[model samples]
Structures are given as structure tokens and as C-alpha cells.
Target: MTATPDIVPPTEVRMAEIVFPNHTNHMGTLFGGQALAWMDKAAFLAAARYSRRAVVTARSDQVDFKLPISVGQMVETVGRIVEVGRSSMKVEVELIAEDLHTGERKLCTRGHFVMIALDENHHPTAVPALPADIAGP
Candidate 1:
């Protein structure tokens, strides 16, 4: 039998955005809603990369804001597929806030998102199965 493919988390997807005044709340911290939106986008990218098809957010698991991301910080989001099913993928996304000047990074938030692959007709479809051997936590 042919060997199955393998995937890893670190190389799955990487997304980054600079936090601006508009993305923050009155307290000068990144808005929770904005962080969720960014995480969703990162998850979508990871799902699409894993399945090689169009995907949509099905549901999101618990999200925790560990720390505040202040304005002018660089928000880096990393996403990878943690679980794969027939048509759905569970992706975990972590947000890191970096001090633009000092290059210090800290975990700001983390979340898990589920995405469903879609066919051309806009209906849910099967996605490629994960290989038996893969790397990543």
C-alpha cells in the first residue's frame, strides 16, 4: 500500500497582524471580539491547508485570554490541525503578542475552532484523512 501523508503543526499555518488603536478597547487592550475573529481566520487557513479545500467555521471551543495585547504590539497567530474527522477539522490557534520595539513575546490568547470542508455546491464534504504518523502537539 502507498504511504500516507503526514502533517505538522508548526508549519501548518502562520498569520500575523499589527495591533492598532482601532483594534483595542477603551482600556488600550486588544478587544476580545477582534482576537476571536483573528483566531477564526487562522483556524480557517489551517483547515484549508490540511484539507486542501474550502472550509467554514463550524464551532469554536473554549477561548481564554491569558494576557492583554496592547496597541502597537505585533499579534502573531499560529494554527494547526489537532484533530481530523470525516468532514470536520479541529484546529488550535494561539496568539502571541510581541513588543514591537523589544521583540518580547507572550501568549495572549488561545482557542480551538472547528471547520467543515465545503464542496463546490456549498455543501459539507469529506476531507482528507490525517496520516497515521505525524508530528505536533
Candidate 2:
């Protein structure tokens, strides 16, 4: 049997807020799809910051939600390049929701997203070497 490779740690962490009314379920919780959409966005931003090129999401691993995020929560999303190839990068993502009022935070979900950098012609393009600090960890 082929062994699954280990997931590498993130080289950087990016965070953003979960504004009110973003909680769509009427259960005082953010929607799962919304969380996913934002996580993917965050991953792309981090990858672009490191790669210095336009990047697109090629794949998103199954997302596992461990908790819910409510309105007024400060959601922090972190991404790391777990793997890199000629023109592709696999980023590990984690989302945490913090209750601003109580200062309580909960891990909402974790997943992996694969992104590919693109050239002006929209063709796959090579990514620059990860920053020395962002290299394989």
C-alpha cells in the first residue's frame, strides 16, 4: 500500500474578521460554505505573498469543522505551503473563531488546498523558491 505523505507546517499565518450577518444559519454561527470560501481566499493570499505571482485554487481537501463561529467573532485563518512542485503548491489551512466579547477562540476547521500559479497567458507558471524561512520545515 502506498503511504500517505505527512502534511507540512505552515510558513505563515493570515487572519481576518468574521463580521456580523456573515453568520447565515440564524444559529449565531457562520455558514460552513462561507468559512470554506474565505479559507480558500486566505490560502491564495498567503501563497501569492510568498510566490509573488497570481495563483489559483486547483483543489480543496475535505474540510472538517470542529466548532461553530458566531457573529462578533474574530476569525483567524492560517495557511502554509505543505508541498511544492514545478507549478503547484499544496497549502494547509486552519480556521479559528474567536468570541470578541469573551475572548474565547475555537478551532473551526482544518483542510488543505492546492493552488497553481499562472502566467499572464493564464498558463501554469513556476513559483519562486519559498522564502528561506518559508522553505521545507
Local accuracy by lDDT, each model = 0.88, 0.81
Which 10-residue window of candidate 1 scores lowest in summed lDDT? 128-137
List, residue by residue over 10-90, the lDDT tens digit for candidate 1: 326888899999999999999999999999999999898888889999999999999999999999999988788889998
Which ten contiguous residues of candidate 2 have the minimum total lDDT?
Answer: 6-15
C-alpha-based local distance difference test score of model 2: 0.81
List TM-scores for all candidates, in order.
0.88, 0.81
Alpha carbon deviation, residue 109, candidate 2 (Å): 0.8
Off by over 4 Å in 2: 1-13, 131-137
Each model's RMSD to truth, in Å? Answer: 3.7, 9.1
Candidate 2's TM-score reads 0.81
Clashes in model 1: which pairs? none
For model 1, the local distance difference test gives: 0.88
